[model samples]
Target: MRIYKVGGAVRDRLLGKPVTDIDWVVVGATTEEMLAKGFRPVGADFPVFLHPNSGEEYALARTERKSGRGYGGFTFHASPEVTLEEDLIRRDLTINAMAEDDQQNLTDPYHGQRDLEARLLRHVSPAFAEDPLRVLRVARFAARYAALGFTVAPETLELMRQLSESGELEALTPERSWKEISRALMENQPQVFIEVLRACGALKVLMPEVDALFGVPQPPAHHPEIDTGVHTLSVLQQAALHKQPLTVRWACLLHDLGKGLTPEQEWPQHIAHEFKGLKLIKAVNERFKAPRDCQELAMLVGEYHTHGHRALELKPSTLLELLQSFDVYRRPQRFEEFIAACEMDARGREGLEQRSYPQADYLRGAATAARTIAVQPLLEKGFKGPELGEAIKRERLKALKAYKENA
Candidate 1:
């Protein structure tokens, strides 16, 4: 059994980036051979084993055939006849299709190394069409590597467009779509991801709510671009530029999702879009099976768009009351996430009169300060038992009053 490093570990190593996980390809090895060597068989559909000692995965060199639809419709072949070269040829992208032997010998029959050098993302073969997931993968790679100046190969993008047009994207599960989206949200430039998906026609299939933003008009007074899509993208750009966390970045992306549906009869008609967006986001969260924390964060973004800044100036009692509006203790990070998202949202518009809301800066600063102060048990104040609870309540009221008076 010959073992070689494959996938992200090798790609990261070649790029001089820190390697996180290592995958191995086992050449000339059978499941029986692996089991004989004390490797535990774990994969249900593919011949994957874990080393008994190291616990690292060692997948037998295999090839795949399209069996049904979407990403999951694949049949893998791992017989003795399947060569490592043939296995690599079936991979999604040229850069990821290369592997290295245990002795550091390169096995790049697909010219992945040259493509890597050229900072290009190219498909290994026409067989790429067999997997619809490759389009999302390419969009993700665009988000991750575009900052390094990599460009997707033209033919590969054409193939992605064709896949979208063929409706293969419809077969993708929302869970799978969100997985790629979450990764993109975690990237340095999530806007690139949205743009890439839009270019490939995958965005409309995956998230039609966002697609509706494309041509929806915004007020000229607030948004110079006059399109909800551009405004949403601008917010995403700010989130990326600030390097916000995943949930905050997602909040920025979805913050204006309801604006497209808001009436355009009056300028800035999206004033109440945040309220509408909350229900829509909840439905989306449920459909995508988002975690409770993410769902709560999205809802908070929708509910408090106008009041988040005002919340900072509330008295301690009022602040505590506001905090109780949601499970702040269980999800302490959501407030800051909301602030970051709202900041991005407020800053996204292109043409606001010079001084529409000077309170924004004050509100942001106050929110940050409030968070820092709230971490301490000011209510306890050297009291114990029932007195402790009373002191805590009194201090909360005092803090809220202080905040409001100061603002």
Candidate 2:
């Protein structure tokens, strides 16, 4: 059997990047031979093993035939007869199909090195259309390498569009779809992920609520970009530009789903859109089964981002109510994420990206002032049970009132 480093480890190494994960392909190897050599079986669908000492994944060279639909419908064939070239051809991208030997020699039968130098993301073969998940995977790779000037080959994009149009995207499990989405959101250029998905038509199938935002108008006096879809992507870009966490990024992506529901006659005006967006956001949250922290934060931001933008003008009571709605006292970090999402919204407008968002500071100051109200002092004054709770609330409001006046 011959072993060679393959896939991402080889790709990233050529790009002068730090490789964190390594995968190996064992050519001319059988399951019996692997087991005889102390390799532990791991892969359920194929002969993938964990090297006994290095503990890294070493998959037997295998070929696949499409037997059904979605990403899980493939039948794999593995044996000594499966050539390394055959296994490499099944990869999603040419840039990921190269391999490296122990002596650091390269085995690049697919011209992956040439594509790397050209800054291209091309498919390994037409078989790329068989697996629906490759659409998301390619979109994610586009997001990851966007800053490096990589663009998907036009043919690859056409294939992605065909795959999306085939309705295979809808066949994917929610958990699988969300895994790609969350990872793409955390990439250096999260907005590119959205743009690539939209370009390939996958966005419309996987996230129709988001897809409907395109061509929708917003009040141009505030949004020079004019399109709600453009604004949403810009907001997502801002979240990534500043390295905001996934909760903030998720909120930014869906903050304006309600705008898509506005009547055309009401075009530029989306009165009460904030409240209208809550149900759509909840649907998305339920669909993906997003983590509780991500779900709760996205919901709070979607419903109250308007409040965050208008913090300076809100009454002290309104500010206190907003803080309470976010459970600021119990979960201050989530509140901060809400503020960050609001800031992303404000700066996401065209030509307004560099503008300062005082509302963020204003809300943060109000939260700080209200949260510092001490309940122990009220308890010492003999307030009891529900009365003590009411007294604490009153004190928090008083503190916020004072803070507003000072500002």
Error of 2 at 183 (Å): 0.9
What is candidate 2's lDDT per residue for 1-407, written digit by digit as tens? Answer: 99999999999999999999999999998899999999999999998999999999999999999998898999999999999999999999999999999998999999999999999999999999999999999999999999999999999999999999998888888899899999999999988998999999999988889999999999999999999999999999999999999988998999999999999999999999988988999999998888888899888888899898888999989988898898889989989899999999999999999999999889889989998998888889999999998999899989998999999
Per-candidate count of clashing residue pairs (backbone under 3 Å):
8, 0
Residue pairs with clashing backbones, model 2: none
> Once model 1 is optimally superposed onto the true structure by TM-score, how far is the C-alpha of residue 16 displaced, in angstroms?
2.1
Candidate 1, TM-score vs. the true structure? 0.84
Reference-based TM-score of each model: 0.84, 0.98
lDDT for model 1, on a 0 to 1 scale? Answer: 0.78
Local distance difference test scores for all models: 0.78, 0.93
